[model samples]
Target chain A: MNQFNIDIEHTGDYAVIRSDGYINNLGGEKISEECCRLLESGCRNFILNLEKSPIVNSIGVSILIELIERVLESDGKLVFTNLTSTIAKTFRIMGLLQYAGAFPDELTALDEIKKM
Target chain B: MTVQEIKEIMLTVPMIPDMELAVTKTVESLSRFIPFTGDQVDEVKHAIIEACMNAFEHSRSADCRILLVFKVGPCKLTVEIVDHGKGFDPALVEDPKIENKLFKNVRKRGWGLKLMKHLMDEVDIVSNRNGTVVRMVKYADAYRKEALNESV
Candidate 1:
């Protein structure tokens, strides 16, 4: 309900980050910072749940792209779950789909990430 | 009352953080009268936000103001975002690809126009030294068509 809020849950194998509210520059930076901290902790696989954060701008998405590149550099995996139609299409248009995966929910995304 | 009336709204907000949400709030009100579906509404909000962010980040307007006009017609919505700042040529903006953004060194903040174009049915940009105007349209006709097919 805030302008932006991020909640991260670390499972044994991967992490699930739930994002809520509009994703602008500040929101993106927050997400990036969290992902960095997770990466430093040796959590490579990630499933980002965006159900509560349906609205996003290009700047925020660009930061996601940056995160994708950084994770790929480490041979880590990233997937998105609970994305709206527009978000999925935007990812496709921006070619993020080529590097990451998008599923209907966290369980599906987790299944996919495990195979990666 | 013989002719169809077009519902319209004009709003002005300062170029600051989170002002785009104000414009989208107006859009939500308009969508109630229009025929846009949930997906279409999300696309419109996203496109509008991108436009506002582009101006907020690059326009550097003296007054730091953004002007938005929403015109609602039959099965169509047209939005124009204007900023009275030094503008650049839209043709000169480099098309960003994920390949380059992923492997090579580049800034990742220039995907605004691309997003607006893809999300809207039509998009036209006019820019000069005085200001910039981004006019975009989203038609509800496609939704209507799908609904009609479903009913058939």
Candidate 2:
């Protein structure tokens, strides 16, 4: 399948990336590329909307890890919003909840990002 | 096997279009017997994709092929994925209850094994001197019941 479809939008310091479809190894590559694209545009804060994305493979998870690392390394932050229960569990199990923040709703995530 | 059957079925292919089908037609033949819902089919597809990609990405070989064999019986469906790469530790795969925190160091990526275990009723990984093969099974009735309960 075509990894994932990415949509980019900006608000203040945060760059929101909305992705749908299977996020596997190929998906990870695309996400990484998009993260790089926004970083080049000088946007650091990120909110990843995975609500529409019901499934995520380990490779995709790894990419998210790398993205989180990238953000943390740059002294920024990454948040996940609108996550399906399964994907949310995967992230939680993978220890993503420690470094990254997850919001029950997008407005909440956006609100938190505004405060940051 | 029958070339005709292989051609007619949805065989697994690598992410790359140009290469020969990364998995064999036998793989699909085996899948026919395994009982899967639309959702399960998607999960198996994702699991296979992750496993094959691990072989293709981590190993040196560029054009390697992974073989998937599906054996469907009256009550159960079994999938066997064989790869031509050096195997790693299955122990390293993370537990799903480890809390919501990313592990630092990132010495290895092994959540794929964990995914397989969660998706399949039974998962067995055998990595020896002769490459690696991961086997998974799903029961038709049990899956249906669980899926029904979840939907309700």
Give the winner by lDDT. Answer: 1
Q: Per-residue lDDT tens digits of candidate 1, residues A1-116?
A: 23799999998758999999888778889998999899998999889999999888888888998998898897899999999999998888888899989999999898788776
Candidate closest to the true structure, highest DockQ: 1
By summed lDDT, the worst window of 10 consecutive residues in model 2 chain A runs over A84-93
Lowest summed lDDT window (length 10), candidate 1 chain B: B1-10
Candidate 2 falls in which docking quality class? Answer: acceptable
Tens-place lDDT per residue, model 2, A20-66, is: 87676677778778887888777888888887776676767887887
Clashing pairs in 1: none
Residue clash pairs of candidate 2: A95-B101, A95-B102, A96-B101, A96-B102, A97-B100, A98-B100, A98-B101, B30-B70
The true-versus-predicted C-alpha distance at residue B53 of model 1, in Å, is 0.8
Worst ten-residue run, lDDT, model 2 chain B?
Answer: B2-11
Docking category of candidate 1: medium
How much of the true contact map at the interface does candidate 2 reproduce, as a fraction?
Answer: 0.38
DockQ of 1: 0.68
